[model samples]
Target: MNEAEAAVLIALLHARPRKMSWSAIASEVALRGSATALWDECFPPTLEGVNDLDGHLARAWESLEAWRSEDFRLLTVLDRKYPSRLREIHQVPPILFVRGQLRDDEVAVSVVGSRRASDRGRAVAARIAEGLVDRGIAVLSGLAEGIDAAAHTATLKAGGRPIGVIGTGINRSYPASNRALQAEVAKCGAVVSQFWPGAPPQKHSFPMRNATMSGLGRASVVVEAGEHSGARIQARLAVEHGRPVILTDMVVGATTWARDLLARPGVYLANSTAELMDLVDQLTRTAAGIDDWSNVLPDLVDH
Candidate 1:
């Protein structure tokens, strides 16, 4: 389909991410003459032809207007400016609400760990963020309290970009404490979310946030996590998304969950920034041989 046609279908699919797969809905939109025709076919028919969807459409326009006023861009899957890495993943969001500008050919590396980070964990997380950003990578994180915050701060300190994939809506900052940091990331890099304009931080939102964070990156680095930490969830999601997951020494040697991860084919253990960078290089080189991530397509997601 043409880009505009595809984006309209993508925007429609956002309402039913799991219920409507791209290939299933694409056939209908692709053959339709225009977006208006496609919408007519999709929206349930009503006696007056007005339908209840007009309400939804009105609210959406309001949201778009709010986004415009704030200069936050809403990226559809087929939009040229959409993050390519995020497009090629299972359950990929059809819409991304983004604050700040996306750098040309941006490459993100997710750095995750426990929010209640140990001293060493915080230090290592910052070191990894600094190392990755120095190499021209955007350090992607959840913008949580401890390790995520440290990594973002270090990336900024190193004069590098940092993308915060937050769980809350683009309009509201989670933890409330990271409000300034959230604004800073938008200035220096981006603060992104798949949630709606005013969605609050629900407990269940973060597991999905982890997957979104994983999809934004070429690879993921788990600097520290207790056995049941959310960082481990992100690492697993990274592996499932076909991205390499780098586990720190503390996690690899101590956590049973991480031991299983280390045994996986694409997972690696790194004790220092040097080792982490080496693994990142190896994984990137391997990925480069297989796919052009910049030209990612919808079919590439489910494959």
Candidate 2:
């Protein structure tokens, strides 16, 4: 897709109420270009009609362009460089607008918990994140209040990389309180969002944002989560994406579901930084020969 077309596709994806299919995107592109051209730009198969168009390609192109102006980038599943861990999710975001340098040899751990976390819970999150950073792990969070804030702040204080993936635009920080934290994360690590510039946070956006948190990391650590928590959703997504999930006993009164998570294969129960880092180390070691580590490692390191 050309620059203008890519911009238009991004705008349309951002503007549409219902999700647009690839054939629909191709039709839109066909307004300015030939069907054959649109198909070739977005789809590979020979197109007999609109049904043969690839909508995913258009979404991917627009997403890549969203962060192209930044020093880092936005990568789509179509791009060979997109992170493999994230691609394992069924409903993965069509594109991820990333910033900062994605390097090799670092580690990533998603630290998530209740937004209304208790003081003790917040402290645990902070200390764990700090320790993880000390060991060269990138702290990934939703940029929410409570535990999310604690994790990001702790990573920053430890002189480590902390990536904040938001439910809104990178240009717009939600909650209006973490503006300073957002700036710090942007300066030191990366402030990322799938939403376009100026997009406002909606009630549904947070759930969507959790997927990115899980996708960006090799392992996810849940510091605290109540029944019906978004953190649970993130944990499930992490498992579905084939990433290790480390559940902490930080939350009071575990849900039957949460209890079963520990019994599930590949899920570990972590009570300290040692357990968390061990999980991360194992994942990194297992993925040693993989090329996607080139992007995953740097994101996990101390920037």
Candidate 3:
């Protein structure tokens, strides 16, 4: 089978009958060097009377074709189109369903915060997003309301790329009201999801989405988050992924987690937009090899 077909099969393995976890499948496939080989081993055609598995595979294949017809692209770890930065993370998804385009060379930074953001928080998010765009970096975020909306809107207004990584299936929109915004992001940049095309939003999916968002970006900026916010989860994941985390003064002052995270490497606190932009500049330069990366944040260099 071709890689694409194997990817479909692997995705199928994660469904009802087989019910294998994605991480387990990813690890097995990586070790085996081919999802097709793994699938064949798991369900040998000669082994027997598995009518149910056969039906499920057929249905999944049909869904794959339908998704393709609707302009959705399926990218697996086997595909070169999968985001390289994401592949470096431990929690990398086995597959990604994408609605627009994803360039391997795209330089992005995630701007995340609370869904119930304050006016100042929203303004800060927008300014940071605009500054990121001005520096030619793509803005990445969960397509939720409040701070995420502000950042994405600012990025679009600046005529910059806005990548929306949603918790729901790429074909579905959460909060429902952001459907148009999601479509716009898909048209202007990309809308990405790791779940099946028909999967609905679940309580646990948002944190998973945050982990994926952290993996996709070179850094994550927490504009404003409460102690228990999803942005806080992303901040923690970013640090674990060895990516930098930038917390605004407001966030640092408001949340214990933000203050605690400061003690970790690759984590910085920005008191102003200028300071935030300066750190972004330093990071960009460091990434480009134009400057010493260690000098940007001495502790982070070791990671």
Candidate 4:
């Protein structure tokens, strides 16, 4: 099938499938080796009892065209332009609607934390983001207020790419205040969403967005977050994705979750900007195959 047809079919599968989760649909498509083939098998046009399948396909096509006209790129799991690291995660979205470019080999680190960030936390986030920029790495975040905003703003000022993996649709901005910042990121790097083009922010979407954020980044840096902060969710998801997580001393002292995660493999504690950057540097080296992770964190090694 052509790219457009495949993309539309994936969207239809996401919308029309009953009882099957998007992940399930994605896995089935992967296993079947083609979305078109999966559609033909499960929802053939001549299949009995399948209602309005054609209408759904027509709407999906219209949505795709609308997104394209607005310069939003639709990337399916089948697309070569899809972020390669993201494909490694179990919670990989079936589709991504992106407002900017996504480089398959881009080296990025997620800098995320509490939305109601303390001044010190914001400063620390900015410092960490600037450091990443200096090292020629892109900064990825959820594009929320406080820590996420600080990181993106710092990355922009440092003339670095700022990738925003947002909870809301690529066409909509959450918290409203960051609308301009979202647009700037789209221009400078990317604003990515797994949701359909017009989908609004929902309670469950942020955690899902966090998962994607962790999947996209080389590692996640939690500058400061409280017990219930979404940053904590991203940190946990990062560890699950087998990506390293760097937590600030403040966060560890403030949240039990942070303290609990410290014992996990690939989770590190950073007491200062220097320490954070050192951990990030080690992660970069490990990703490049220049250094072994066990050499960097011997305690994390299995005896």
- List, residue by residue over 167-225, the lDDT tens digit for candidate 1: 98888998899999999999999999877768999987798889889988888899888
Largest lDDT belongs to which candidate? 4
lDDT of 3 at 287: 75
List per-prediction Cα lDDT, in the order shown.
0.75, 0.69, 0.82, 0.84
lDDT of 2 by residue, 23-132 (tens): 35434443554333444444344546432243544564555655567565655444456565555555556555666654434568889998889898899899888877
By TM-score rank, best first, the candidates go 4, 3, 1, 2
Which runs of model 3 end up more than 4 angstroms from their true locations?
1-4, 15-19, 47-54, 288-296, 299-303
Candidate 4 has its poorest 10 consecutive residues by lDDT at 294-303
TM of each candidate vs. truth: 0.83, 0.74, 0.90, 0.92
Candidate 3 vs 4: which has more TM-score: 4
- True-structure RMSD for candidate 3: 3.3
TM-score of 4: 0.92
Model 2, 246: alpha-carbon shift in Å?
0.4
Q: In model 1, what lDDT does residue 195 have?
A: 76
lDDT of 4 at 230: 95
Q: Please give the lDDT score at residue 97 for candidate 3.
A: 90
Model 2, 8: alpha-carbon shift in Å?
A: 6.6
